[model samples]
Target: MFKYLKNDIPASIVVFFVALPLCLGIALASDAPPLSGLIAGIIGGIVVGFFSGSRLGVSGPAAGLAAIVAAAIGTLGSFELFLSAVVLAGAIQIFFGVIRMGIIGYFFPNSVIKGMLSGIGIIIILKQIPHFFGYDSEPEGADSFIEKSGETTLSALAHITDNITLGSMIIGIVGIVIILFWDNILSKKHAFFKILQGSLVAVVVGTILQVVFSSNEALKIESLHLVQVPAPEKLSNFIDYLSFPDFSQIFSKDVVLIAFTLALVASLETLLSVEATDKLDPEKNVTPTNRELFAQGFGNIASGLIGGLPITQVIVRSSANIQSNAKSKLSAIIHGFLLLISVLTIPMLLNHIPKSVLAAILILVGYKLAKPSLFKKMFSLGWTQFVPFIVTILVIVFKDLLWGISIGLVIGIIVILVKSYQNSMFMKISEIDAGKTTKLVLAEEVTFLNKATIQKELFNLHENSSLELDIRKTRYLDYDVVEIIEDFLIQARNKNIHVHLLSERGNVDNPESFIEFLKLDKIKTNETN
Candidate 1:
């Protein structure tokens, strides 16, 4: 990890800037003190980063959990109680890791995963727009389409003209230009530009702009439109900001329920981020998901102990780290240290930085995640992939992350069911002088899901048909499908249909009964095995 210090150090600086506001914003959205987010960022970076197997994934207070955290805090009656829940949640996540439940991430389809990344990217862009223009109506880290202020994302945009601040707009536009130029032109031309990432440059320039315009009334940006790091007057006063959990509430039923919910949701978010980060990794190194859970659990436990919001392996910071040219987990660790030092030593300097500059950095990050090329590529993969991918994006954009993903999973499962039903059996019908001959070919694996389709096909057969059932390709036949076939065979007699059963063991004419035939088939299959 130390081997890439030259790259890691600079990359860490970029991630630090990217993570700073996010930490505060998430805390604000969660209705927790801003300092709590910083603590989580610190722990997530230093603690989780050290334990995580992932070389690039960055952990911090997640916007995805903002609503849950807010609701939990309110429901629990106190922040201290909520902190207890967070600690328990971390313990539960560690249990999940111990039991190897990290494999849950692998269960999500590739299309859905891609959709998640793209959807998050779109959300980041939308959420950042108001900040970029100095419209600070909604909290910085709120991810839902519907804001607590009662403004929808589209409506927010529509009102942008009325709320735009001259200083913020100017700084934001210049910041964006600097980043774009650095990424597209300056970085290509010079090594210095590569080492000093565009995001940092944009931030520096925006800070300088803020100072230069501070004296001008109309052009000045407000304190609310800048980074808001809590600045304690003295070093000793910092301890006052640290919160401790109420251990007495550990046994409370509501606390336990909240803990379980946090554990389940945080674990899921971590796994998905692990997958996304690995995909984004230049070296394509696979992270150990179970280890990631362990790291996250530890981070959250540490975070909760100090009155912080729950931590997860966040995609926003991870992607920012990757795009900033992070080399290893060292970058993530270093960023945490930076967060610690910034809050302790130079918070006022941080406060000088414009929110619009950070918004510009995130806009670029968002663009990378939701590139138009990705949409076209998904479409080219056919509807099987495209439908879920698009639905996930749309739902996430219009709703929230979890709901979008849940709906996408439903759509993906439905698509699978449809395909399974269609492929369960292959039927070919031919007209013969006697009547009609129907040949039914069973798939390699027949499940209960195929029963309805098979029954419908059977019902559609001609009254005087001669039916040939082929089971040579079938490996495992479900009991429900077998029952369907049995019921069809019984009905065949009344329809004057003659049935011929074909298997690897050759043909049988008019099997005595479906149950007996299935038993014989099973015996043959076992013998062959």
Candidate 2:
């Protein structure tokens, strides 16, 4: 850990700046106290950092769970009651880790996973656009396709003229231009650009612009968003922000149900982020998923105890950490410390940093995750992969992130089932001496689902042909498939082809019904008999 700290310390500062607005934004979206998100980010980074086996994984309050958290607060009648559920969720995640359920992430199809990443990337970009123009009606980086302001993400963009702030827009455009210039040109110069991070430079510029514009007061640039860190005059005054759970609601069945839902969703989000962040890492080091869950459990417990939102390994923050060149868990720890220090000491300075700068940074992060090259790569994998992938993206863009993923997963499962049904049964026919002799082999197991494939294989037999169907090893044959086989026999007769059945247990007691059969002898049977 100490060895990793050399590079990680500076990286943490980058992650800290990136995480600050997100923490407040998500907390505001969830309708929880603005400080709760910060508390979660701090605990997730500092506490989980110590226990997590991941080098690049950064944990925090996730946007994926914001709707759930918001709804939970309403259902539970208080934010404190929701905290109780968060605590329960942590315990549940710990149970999952103990049971080694982390392997569940492996079962997710690659196409769906890629689709999820792309969807989230698109969402991040869309959500930040409004913030870039200094529209503060909605929280920054909210991913739901249906905007909180009652319109689609794209529509909100079209209506941006109504809510635009000239100052923030200017700062945002300048920040984007600087980042692009530094990344695309100056960084290659191998001079001062290497010493000065592009994003850091853009943020500084944005901050300076904000101060200058605010001082002038003549431009009337209203709606500029900033990080609002609650200040306490004394240590005792800080206690007002602390929230306690209402244990009286613990026994309610509704509370238990919501608690379990939170656990499940939070666990899935954490697992997904764990996988995604590992892929984003430049080192390509894999994090132990079970260990990650255990760490998340502890982090969530602490977060809830301190009146914070439920914690997960958030992909947005983790990606920022990776892009920032975070080297180890130390980066996560340091960022958490930065959160504590910034909120406690320099909140006024934080309040001065314009939202557009953060939006520009997130826009860059979004581009990296949803590059056009990714779409081409997915298409090259074929329709079996592309169908679900595209569907997931559309669903996410049109509906919600969770809904899109669920749709993709269902489609993926259906594709697998179709392939399995076709492959489970097979028939092969070969013609010798120009179709005089042929061989037909029944598959190991022929079920009703395989009737179409089997029928197609049998109908292709040649006229005046001698064929052999070997089914001696087959243990089970459904009646629907048997009927198809019998129908094929009739068709073969009309075509002047000989069909031979390979079976020892062909009692065929019910001549009209193909399913009827009994084993009179213990010996195996085949077409040779």
Candidate 3:
């Protein structure tokens, strides 16, 4: 781990800056206290990092879990009660790990997985749109069909004018520009800025600007778009904010259901993130899924015990870690340590930082995830891959993330079933004597679904034509399909066409005997001629 210290340390600092705002944002989105997200992040990095088998997977307060947390809180009627569910979820995940259910992740098709990632990328960008434009009424990290503000997500886009914050917009643009410049220009020009990281620089600049603006009353900036942390004067006061779960609600069936939902959603999200992060690792390291689940379970339990938000392996922070050159578990470890130190020592410093700056960083993260090239590549891959990919993208963009993924999965399964059906049965014709004596061979194991196509081919035969259907290779024939074959044999006799049925276990000359011998219905194959 220390071998890459020169590169990894700098990367961890960058990731730390990137993670700081996300921790807060995800917590805010979940309707949990802002510090709860930070706490989760700190524990994610320290506890999960120490125990995780992943070389690059980063754990945090994931946006994907925001909906679960919010619904759980609303149902449980208290954030503390919801935390109990989180602990239960962690315990369940640990059980999943112990049972070695890691292989479940592979059951998802590659097409579906790609669609899922792309769909999620689109959702992240869409959900972050209001935040990027200085509108926060809809809640942070919301990617649901029905938003918390009682509007479909797109309708909220139209309502952005009503809740626009000028300070946030202005600072957001400035922050975005600073990040773009730093990433594209300044870092190339100066070593110090390169060392500091574009995100950190943008945060610093945003903080300085906030301070400068706050000093002047004429600027007229509200504190709503700024980070807020409870200032504690002493250790005891700080500890006062710590709360535990109200297990009194545990007896409620609703609470138990909510716990199950959290466990499933959190586990699935973490598994997907682990898959994605491993692909992004520079070293191409593979994370042990079961072990990662166990680590995440412990992290979530710790987070819940401390009034922190539910945690998962988050791709945004993981990607940031990769871009920041993080190596080994050390980067994650140091970043967690920094989280503890920063919240404990300089929360006021965090307050000075504008929300727009963080939004800018997230916008960058969003863009990275849903880059234009990804869309183009999907299109170029052809209809089978492209259709589901595009559908997933559009659905995610217009609908919700989960809905879009479900749609893509449905479409992908349809494609698979169609392909399988097409391959399940076939017909072979040998043209001889100018198609007069065509030999038609039926595929192995004919089913009812293949009847129509075969019937169509049979009807195309001319009067007095000869047709042979070889079913010796067929192990199982559906009753409906056998009936269709029997009906066709009668039609062939009437049309002056000769029909032949070849089966290893049946009488080939007597059609009815062939059917009876094959254990099919007592259908007549033909007059035993």
Candidate 4:
């Protein structure tokens, strides 16, 4: 872990800056104490990061769960009650890991995974646009298309123009310019430029601009547009921010239901981020998904015990860390320390940093994730892959993260079913002296999905036609398919169609029963599926 300290430290700083507004915003959105978000952020980075197998993933209070958290809190009648559910959720996640359910991440199609990354990227860029111009009505880290503010994601742009702050826009533009310049030019010039990342420099410039513009009424950024950390000057005062879970109701029916829901969603979000972050890593190391689940379980348990929102491996911070060129998990661990230290010692100074500077940094991260080249490449993969890929992006942009991915998964499944129906068998037809001659060869794997097509071809056979059924190449067969063939054999007798069954065991001029013949041949049957 110490092998890449140089790279890790610099990346940690950038991630810390990126995580600050997110922690505050998600907490506010969840209707909890602003500090709860930070607590989760700290635990996620320190505890989760310490145990996680992922080299680049950074965990925190995710925006994807804000609405659910808020609803859970409201339904449970108190924040303390919600904390109990969070604790229970952590236990459920641990159980999931014990059962090796983390393999769920591997089953997702590649197209859907890419779409998830690009969709999140597009969301980051669009959502930050309002903040870039200093319209901060919506809390930071709120990613849903429909916001608590009663405005849609795209509609929020309309208000930005009228509420735009010149100071914020100016600083935001400069921040973007500085980062781009430092990354593309100065960083290449010397190691000095590389150590002091462009994002840190932009934040410093943004803070100084806030102080410099204080004298001008039109230019000075208001407190609303700056970081809103709840600063505590003393250690004792900071302890007041912690909230403990009410464990009496931990086993209540409603609480257990909410816990299950949270566990399912949080695990899904974490696995998705793990997949996405690994892809973003230049080294392409595969994170152990089961270990990640176990790490997150402890992180949430710790957070809930001391008054914090639920946690998950977040793609945004992880992406920022990866883009900042973090070489190891040390970047994530140190960022947690930075959050703790900053909150304790310099929160007042941090509050002076304009949100616009952070917005600019995120915009760059978003652009990298949703680059136009990715679109062209996905399109080149053809419609079978592109349809679900594009659908995932649209739904994510219009709906939310889980909805988009789920719908994309459904689309992928449908495509597979259609392909199965069309390619279930190969047929050859010609006229013989006795009548029409039809030869049907089964596909490599026959499933219930292929039942309909097989039935249709058999039904279309002409009277007095001679039929040849070949399934020698089919390695796996479904019970539904066997039933369909059995029915066809019955129909053939009435239609006076001659039937021949060909298999590895040899040919039968007319097999009496499909099952008995297959049983004799010892063919594999996947009836359970």
Please provide, for model 2 over 153-218, each residue's C-alpha lDDT reduced to its tens digit, 9 standing for 90 to 100: 566577678867778888889988998999899979874565456777787788888878986664
lDDT of 1 by residue, 1-529 (tens): 8999998998898889778767865665566776788899999999999999999999999866765686688779899999999999999999999999998767777898788778867766776778788875544324455565675556657767876888999998998899899889998997667656677778788999999999999999998887776788999998886889999979799899889878877888898888889999999999999998999999889999988899999987898888888889999999999999988998888789887887777677678879999999999999999999999989877765667778889999999999998899899998889589999999998888898889999988878889988989988788777778778877888888889988876688855754577757854565567
Best by TM-score: 1
Give me the runs in candidate 3 sitting further than 4 Å from their true place: 1-11, 67-77, 109-159, 184-196, 250-261, 280-283, 319-327, 367-404, 426-430, 436-529
Evaluate all candidate structures by whole-model CA lDDT and list the values in order.
0.84, 0.75, 0.74, 0.83
My TM-score estimates for the predictions, one after another, are: 0.81, 0.75, 0.77, 0.79
Q: How well is each residue in 1-529 modelled by candidate 3, as lDDT tens digits?
A: 6788887677777778778878876665565777888999999999999999887777888866664576568768888888888888788888888998777666655565566555555555565566666675764324455656566666667778887766677777888898898889987887666556677777788778777777666443577777777668875688777768777777578777777666766777788888889899988988988898899889988988988888888886787788677778888878898998898898877777676777677667667766888878878887778888888767755654456667877888888766645655555656677657666666555667777777778878889777777776666566787777778778877898777666665437665565566554222322121
Better of 1 and 4 by TM-score: 1
lDDT of 4 by residue, 301-403 (tens): 9999999899999987998898788999999999999988877887788778787887787678678878999999999999889999999989977766567
Clashing pairs in 4: none
Q: What's the lDDT for residue 68 in model 2?
A: 64
Which is the better candidate, 2 or 3, if ranked by TM-score?
Answer: 3
CA lDDT of 428 in candidate 1?
Answer: 94
Give candidate 4's TM-score: 0.79
lDDT of 1 at 163: 66
Model 2 local distance difference test score: 0.75
Total clashes for model 1: 0
Lowest summed-lDDT stretch of 10 residues in model 3?
520-529
